[model samples]
Target: MPIVLYHFPLSPPCRTALCTAKALGLDVTIKIVNLLAKEHLNEDYVKMNPEHTIPSLDDNGLIIWHSHAIATYLVSKYGKDDSLYPVDPAKRVVVDQRLYFDATTLFPRLRATTFPLMFLGKTDVEPDKKAAIYEALGILEKYLEPTGWVAGDHVTVADIACAVTTATLQAMGVVLDAYPKIREWLERCNSTIPHFEEANKEALKDVAELIKSKVTHNVYAP
Candidate 1:
């Protein structure tokens, strides 16, 4: 059976899974879920993804909702080789760490910063929220300094996952001068990753414009 993906173009998680599938050369039927219209809360979509998040993949009968999991599944089942997700246990562990870093550390900050501006009508990013995002960027910089990639020397699923998060944060007006390694790594990802622009650029611009309409101040500004 063919894969069917439930996606929102502006969502980082959706872009992550979409880019992963593209890199693996997998054909997927895209179904747009309009968050503004609450389409993700519909009965069937929620049945497929209990959390009701974007980028749920229905691979035949198996359902994967989370982007990291979707990426892993696509690579394991269809990839010609395991480069995107290494077969070696030691190597896989590093990729796992970076994935969680994106999920637990990186993604939450995006939600925290955006939720208020988008949903609660907050005009400025709270100081703590702004600081939290920079802190994650600092941690990512430390990770990238050694190998120029988040997980290992090669671009793995880890980089794909983090790239969308980092790029989205940048488009939302996060300053990068303090995190030079991340800036350089993002450039490298743009150059190397297949379908990077197709998955991220236009969606990122949309996110930035949406947020710009709400936020009166750039939190990272002095």
Candidate 2:
């Protein structure tokens, strides 16, 4: 059987795994999982991923969850070269830092804002949550100043992971007024990354519509 990806289209993290597979040029069968419906909580799914996260990858018999881990596995096992994940220790750690920042800082902020809006019908993000997201983006801007991409000069899983989050934030009405570098990098990502549009085509639209229904204004400036 081909590699099976348990995915939810609206998830930013799932987009990372899908983008990595596209970049690696691997054929993966995507089986949609509804997080809103508690599909990930199913016994079969929890057995494969105790965390029950969206975007679990079953590569043959090796079941992997968490977008960052799944992405690293696919890249390490199948990448023709180490470009997406450099082999050098120093370079790898830089990429690792950006990946971790995305997981801990960038995406978490997005989740913080969106969860309440999507589930609890909150119209405005709490002030501290807005501040946290912009703080993460400010650091990201400086990271990109040294190199066009987040990890380094070239796109890596770090950029792929963070791009989805930032792009979703944009769709959710977070203006990029202060983060010109991030704006440019995101533009470059859309053009340079393979299957980038296909990777996020519907998710962005869905996010826009969903967010539009919840909030009347765009936010997070400077």
Candidate 3:
């Protein structure tokens, strides 16, 4: 059976796993879980992942949830190149640690600062959220360099994982103009991975419309 990847595009965690899958040349049957339907919060999905979240991998009937865990599992099991996930124990440890930080720390902060305005349709708080976004971006700025990737010289799965989240957050209208390194890194990641863009083909339009609708409605309405 083909591996099944459960995901919701709007979710950063789901995108992380998807990015890793793309990077590794894995043939996955994507099951777009409906987060909007609260399907993730429902009992059936909860059985697959008690946390009730996505970017989960179902491999020949075995389920692995949590985006970081799923991505690590894929790399450990099926990565085509060592650069995608280094075999060196120390390098792997550093990359895995960063993956955890990106998954639990950076991603949550980005969400806290953007999701309320973007997904929740809450426009009145955009200015405040934008400030929070800059703060979180500054955190990311500290780790980023002109090195062309995150975590190392080679574009590891860590870069794929973090880039997907950062790209989505930027797509949500969190300004990245000040973070030139991040912008360059994003382009580098896209150029390196052919499948990341394919999997996210519809995301740009949706995010653009969502941001525009909220901003326009908020600005014009009395």
Candidate 4:
């Protein structure tokens, strides 16, 4: 049986997994779990993924959720070599750090601002939330300063993991102009990744439209 992925297209976490799988040339059966319809709350899906999160992977009988973990696993188990996720401890540490940064710092900050607007029709992001998003972006800028990629020279699962979230923030109209390094790195990721448009662009457009329809004011300034 083909590997199965349960995902919601507009979700960055879901897109991250999709992009990683595509990068590794892994064939997956895509099953859309519409969050708006609460399909993830179904009994069967809940049993497989108690967290009921998007982008859950069912590899044979094994199950996994969380984009970063899934991304790394795909590269580790399926990738012909350790290029996307190097086996060397010193090199892998940088990738691991960036992945952790995305999970703990970047995605949470972006979600804080966009989630209320997208799901609850909030018109504006709270001052603190907006500030937090920029703060996270600032940190990302520094991370990118030393190397072209988030995790060093080569494009790793770290870039795939963080780029999807960064792309979603851009779709939400976050001003990335202030973070020149991030903007450049995002451009590089978008261009270099195969099937980048199919993996991320279209869903990013959906997220942009959803945000535009619900929110009247711009949350990102400067």
What TM-score does each of the candidates earn?
A: 0.97, 0.96, 0.87, 0.96
Which ten residues in a row are the worst by lDDT in model 2?
213-222
lDDT of each: 0.90, 0.89, 0.75, 0.88
> Tens digit of lDDT per residue, candidate 1, span 1-222?
889998999889999999999998888999999887889999988877889888899988888888999999999999999999999999999999999999999999989978888878788887888888888888999999889999999999999999999999988888888788988899989989988877788999998899888866675452
List where candidate 3 sits over 4 angstroms from the true fold: 118-121, 126-129, 217-222
Q: What is the C-alpha RMSD of each candidate to the true structure, in Å?
A: 1.1, 1.3, 3.3, 1.1
Quality of model 1 by C-alpha lDDT: 0.90
Q: Would you list the clashing residue pairs of candidate 2?
A: none
lDDT of 2 by residue, 126-185 (tens): 889988888888998999998799887799999999998999888887888888999999
Error of 2 at 95 (Å): 0.4
Candidate 4: segments with Cα more than 4 A from true spot: none
Model 2 scores a C-alpha lDDT of 0.89
Candidate 4 whole-model C-alpha lDDT, 0 to 1: 0.88
